[model samples]
Structures are given as C-alpha cells and as structure tokens.
Target: MGPGETGLNYMQQLNQIVYPGIGKTTNDNDCFVKSRSIFFNGTTDFEQSIEEEMHRYQLIWENGYFLKTLKEISHILNGENYDWELDIDSKTKNTRSNYIKDAIITKFSKAPNFQNLLKEAYNKDLRNAITHTQYNLIQGGVVLTNIKGDNHQPFYGITFEKWEEIYSKAWFLLRYIFSGLKDIMELFMFHLRKKQSQVESPFSYQMVKNGSKHMHTILKEGTGGLFINEIALTISYISIFEI
Candidate 1:
C-alpha cells in the first residue's frame, strides 16, 4: 500500500468492496445503523459538509482494511518458502503469490461479474467525483458531476440512489473475497495438520460454511434492513417525545 494509492484509480478497482461489521460481536453490531443515524438526526449549516468529510474518511479506512486482507489472502493463495526441513520435499517452494501478483485486485478481474462490478460500483470516474469535491447534496442524494468533455457536452451525473446501489453490490463482492481468504486460512491450518501426519484437524468445514452463508445473507439483505430499523427507531423515539 503506497502513500497515494488511495487515488481514484486504485479505489474503484478493489478498494470499494468493504463489509461494514463483518467481525463484530452481536452486542456491537450497530456500526452501519449508527452511520445511518447521522443522516436521520441533526441539522446545521455545516452538517452536509461534515457528513461528506466523514464519508471520505470512512471510505479511506475501509479500503485500508480491505487491501490489507486482500494481501494476506494473496499470501495464502501464494504460499511462501518455509525451508522447513520438516516440510515435505514438494513443499520446498511456493508459487501462488507469484501467480497472484501480490494479490492486487486488478489481477483477478478476468472473472465474469468482477470487472462489471468494479467498473460500475467503484469506478475511477465515480471515485474522482467523491474524492475531488465535484459533487453536491441535492434532494437528499449525492449528485456527482463530471465536466470533462469539450464544452462539457458529454458530462456525467451519478445520483444518490445509484451510489446506494453500488454500495450494496460492492458489499457482496467484497465479502465474497473475504470469505475466500477465511477459507484459505482454514485450509492452511488443515494442511499443517496433515503435514504432521495428524489425521484430525482443529478446523470445522461446516462452521466455515455456515459463517460464509451467514455473511452472504447479511451483506445481501441486512445492510438495508439495518438502516430501515434504525430509521424506524429514530422516528418512534421522536414520536414518543412529541406525544
């Protein structure tokens, strides 16, 4: 991760796919809900500005985590030379990393839906709109504008609904990759056991399957439901006070 890799070019290719609370406890599962609360509550001359700033910061942090995990997954897929005298002769060297090219997201773009989502959900153009301040909060949605064409004729505008759609799609794609990384880790542990001639493994494939399935359900469904629940809670609280 270089200092300026947060640039739009890098963000859309892989950085935009992030799972909000994938690793939190049940009692701590309020991050997305709380983030939505920012939209429901409060008003100030600087409120929109503040919200946008937070969005940028959060996106940056999310990419930081996303890229880091991707790298580790690359490592697992691309095993390293342990030079373990204990290791089997066939295990003297590893090549997945070489093939993966350091697990950069673009390397895996040959897959079917991947390139499409990367381009549509978190493309370079859209990232520039958010990162470069060429946007507006209009009608309760973020409006992204591009004025690049001659006479600014072929300009582009991305509305808030589209952004939300991108967010949802990005969530599923990113989490699917993360699930792969987790599965790889479990496989690593199993390999270590087999290398030791141990017939039993500490890993549970069923547990991993269940976890992965639950993640799919949540990212695909829970994102919106959490916001709706939060909005309702906020409304109920307000109504109680008013009544």
Candidate 2:
C-alpha cells in the first residue's frame, strides 16, 4: 500500500486495541493485553519495520541490477557507440566493460551504483560492514557490528528517518524505470514495424517507401510524463552518488 494508506491501517489497528468496546478489549488493561497479544501473535515477539527494512535492503541490490540491465539493453539496441575523449592516436583497446561505463556516464551522467541507497538508510561504515558481513536483531532494532571497527567503536543502528528516505527512493526509482522502459519498448516496436514494412515482395510492392511520415504516429505515445516527484524522491535516496 501507499504511505498514507499504510499509516491509516497502522492507526486503525492501534485504535482497535486502544479504544473501548472494540474486539475483545473494553478498557485500558484489556487494551494493553490485546496490543501485547498482537505483538506476539504466533511468534515470541513481532518487531516493527523489520519487513520494510529487509525490503529496503533487497531493493538496494536489485536497483544496482536494474541499472546494469538498462545498460545491457542499451548496448543491444545501439551497439557499442560510446564516444571516447582520448586522443585519436591513443591505443586503448575498446572493451564491453569500458563501453558500458562510458555509455552510462554519457547517457546518465554518472557511474552506476547502489552505494548511495545503502548509505542513506544506515551509517556509511556500518553499511559497508553489513554488506560484507551479517547483522543481528536487537531489542530496539538491528545491530550491525564489525569486529575490527565496533570493537574499538560503537555499533551503528539504521535510523527510522534514513529508512524512510531509502524506501521513498526505492519507489521513486522503480517508477522512473517503469516509465523509461515503456518508452523504450515503444521505440523498439516502431523500428521493428518499420523493418517489417520495408520487406516487400511482388505481392506487396513499395507502398510505403519512407517511414518518416508515420514517425509521429509511431512515437506519439512515448511523450511520457517526467514526473517531478520522481526526481525529488530519488535525489534524497541517491544524493551520495551525485559525486
């Protein structure tokens, strides 16, 4: 559900226990017991935001994979067309890896990374540690420990505000990709159809010599919305990657 709806649901459940004559609770004591019961429903205890925290974690990796997939598709569509700024006499052999990096820098104006998302949700050093190692559940929240770092320092806990920022970014990025992928699909289909129309036999001579006249019809739907919220939300999530 959306954030507003989710907040409403949370309040409704809380009120169901807090308000009198709702469910099996009719007083403060009953309310407290019902709330605790729900907290431990089918389990020893239920921690809040754990599911959302995990979702944010998975999205960080998945977002990186998403960007990689976009580069691959661009390569398939346009081939290795990266514009290198090296001197003409420079003999650096061009490779797919170099081409992908160049293409992303040229098109997206940045290197592909998920580091910002992870760092937004957690302390940067703690994020690096958790990414490499494991985290444990604690009373208030998850504790990320590094034997080398935390042994000399204190553990870092992912903050609620940062988690919200990460989650906001995840939704923003997914929608951004959704809009872009749809536009690309339309462009690809137009090219495919144009190619098919050019294949003429005796039964079907060149009735449509040029596809330029139909270009508007083919790409009309691709003038999609570049929503402002997409950028605003995404900037908060990946601000670190701007460098």
TM-score leader: 1
Candidate 1 has which clashing residue pairs, if any? 78-96, 78-97
Q: Local distance difference test, per candidate?
A: 0.40, 0.38
Per-residue alpha-carbon lDDT of model 2 for 1-243, expressed as tens digits? 022332343444333322322112133534332443343322432333444335444433323334343443333333332121222112213433243235433444343354343234333343344455566544434456653344655666654334445555544454455456555556655754654454432121122323411111111123332222222222233322344
Tens-digit per-residue lDDT, 37-91, candidate 1: 3543336433444354336433632454454444333233334211112111122
The TM-scores, one per candidate, come to 0.42, 0.37
**Against the true structure, candidate 1 has what lDDT?**
0.40
Query: Runs in model 2 with CA error above 4 Å?
Result: 1-48, 59-67, 70-133, 137-141, 147-152, 187-243
Count of backbone clashes, every candidate in sequence: 2, 0
